[model samples]
Target: MYTPAAFRQDDLGELHRQILACRLATVVSQGPSGLQASHLPLLLEPGEGQFGTLYGHFARTNPQWRDLAEGAEALVIFQGPEAYISPSWYPAKAEHGKVVPTWNYIAVHAQGRAEVFEDGKRLLQLVSRLSDHHEAGRAQPWAVNEAPREYLDAMLRAIVGFALPIEHLQGKWKLGQNRSAADQAGVRAGLAASLDPRDRELAARISADHSAEAAP
Candidate 1:
């Protein structure tokens, strides 16, 4: 999250958008045993707080939830597209041979107090919402109600629900903003020609950022 002013993303809506795009977040906490982290698909409840609130579940066997003290502070990191930029992609490399390889990526860090709970009603609501959100994109969407009630109930019994009221959020979009315009354009072109779809995505993000900046 070491972001220069040029690369800092302070827009709340944009931060939420990125978090939604990267649904799986890494939640980190500290306890007597030291730091522990869990990867979970968190759902953001926008407008639930000044920054927003995060909802997710943890497996009953996951020790991270048990070690996490009630109302303890946690950091949820959402990572977006990333790609490696070769020095050869920069025009400056040809001009002065001064450019070195770098990485271009976008990330959001959300800090908040986490509350773990085991209310079955709330857990059902959380599961239904999560299922709907993810299934909406599929041609043949699935639902929690599609399964047998007893089976779903048993499955739900094996998990714990948690909520995090976001106190602060930070975003960093490192898309070659430090480089010259020509160098950035070179990077975009190089990325566009690459075989990796992620590289092309980073290229599009870079171009989009530049476009927004250039807009009146």
Candidate 2:
């Protein structure tokens, strides 16, 4: 991803946080047919590496995984909060007209080779773990067994488990980083003033980042 120095996020911890918050990702790969992309709820296992491996399963009937080489290698894109930045948010726009509309967002790139595991036990374990991870704080936590056994087994059979052994990591945070502090504040203020809940959330995050950066 093309990122200016101000908008670039090299801090591993922050990048990993963004990746974890992103429940879904775009998994892209090159195939004989052409570039293929699949949307999947990816799990990021953080550890010592460029980035921890990503885990997700594909439907067995999905042809995208059919031609893929076994044993891990592909690009997974994890995207965090994103929003359109209106030029109206800029304080300097009225004076010199130096600004243009832009977007603010966070994204992480992970590349690795994937190992396809089809064992029934492994698949069951993977699903159970995933369920726990997502339902940890729920009032009434749901498990795979909440459904009938035959249905669950049939569902599992239709999918294939896989793990990407991560090789590279790239992250960018474009929360108006290229702008001056005053301009960034203006953007954040505008975002906060808006009725959109997502905008308010992003503004809070950008404000927190700014505060952290400005600390002595």
Candidate 3:
């Protein structure tokens, strides 16, 4: 995460909020062979010293976790909306025509120890919490036990639950914070004109960052 001071987000609460918004993340680990990564829907435990405690599971047959992490440290990347910013959007292009394309996005990287194991009860708790958190709005909300008992049990056996207690966290909110106000305004307008929903969403975040900065 090569975040300049302007793009750096030091607020832990905001970082956690963004992480929760994007529940799924990529967990990377290193081992004797080399580096390995797995994409998993992780649950964060938020509190004091809780910024880094993440819980997730992978298929037991997925050797990536076992092969790469023997309780070694890992990095979990929680990504936010992202979009492309055309150089043409910058007002500077009209003056010096020296503007170049850039990307606007938000992401959080959490480094911590990887506890790779399957705890059945812990897995059940995690899945139940995930279900409640994500499916809270459904008319007929989904529950973990909607499946047959035997089937669910066997299915559970196929997966291994794990946690990564974050030792450190870094966040990058590259919403053109380094740009001049005029360029930022142009980017906002350009992104608002884009068709991609992601572009709009990322642009909104960038806008919010600017708004917060302007507040007394």
Give TM per candidate. 0.93, 0.90, 0.91
Query: Which residue pairs overlap in candidate 3's backbone?
Result: none
User: What ranges in model 1 sit over 4 Å off?
Assistant: 208-216
Candidate 2 has its poorest 10 consecutive residues by lDDT at 207-216
User: Ranking by TM-score, best first?
Assistant: 1, 3, 2
Best model number under TM-score: 1
Q: Select the stronger candidate by TM-score from 2 and 3.
A: 3
lDDT of 1 at 184: 82
Arrange candidates by lDDT, highest first: which order?
1, 3, 2
Error of 2 at 36 (Å): 1.2
Query: Using alpha carbons, what is the TM-score of model 1?
Result: 0.93
What lDDT tens digits, residue by residue, belong to model 2 across residues 100-184? 8888888888887777878888898888888888999999999987989998889889999888867888888888766777678
Consecutive 10-residue window with the lowest summed lDDT within model 3: 207-216
For candidate 2, the per-residue lDDT at 182 reads 68
* Root-mean-square deviation of candidate 1: 2.9
lDDT of 3 by residue, 1-216 (tens): 798777888898898898889968998878776888888888888863656588888888877678535677788898999888999998888988977888888999999876777767777887788788889988989999887988878877888887777788999988877777888888888888888888888777765347423211
Best by lDDT: 1
Off by over 4 Å in 2: 48-50, 70-72, 208-216
Q: lDDT tens string, model 1, 111-213?
A: 9877888888899999999999999979999999999999988989999999899998999988877777777888899999999999998888876348323
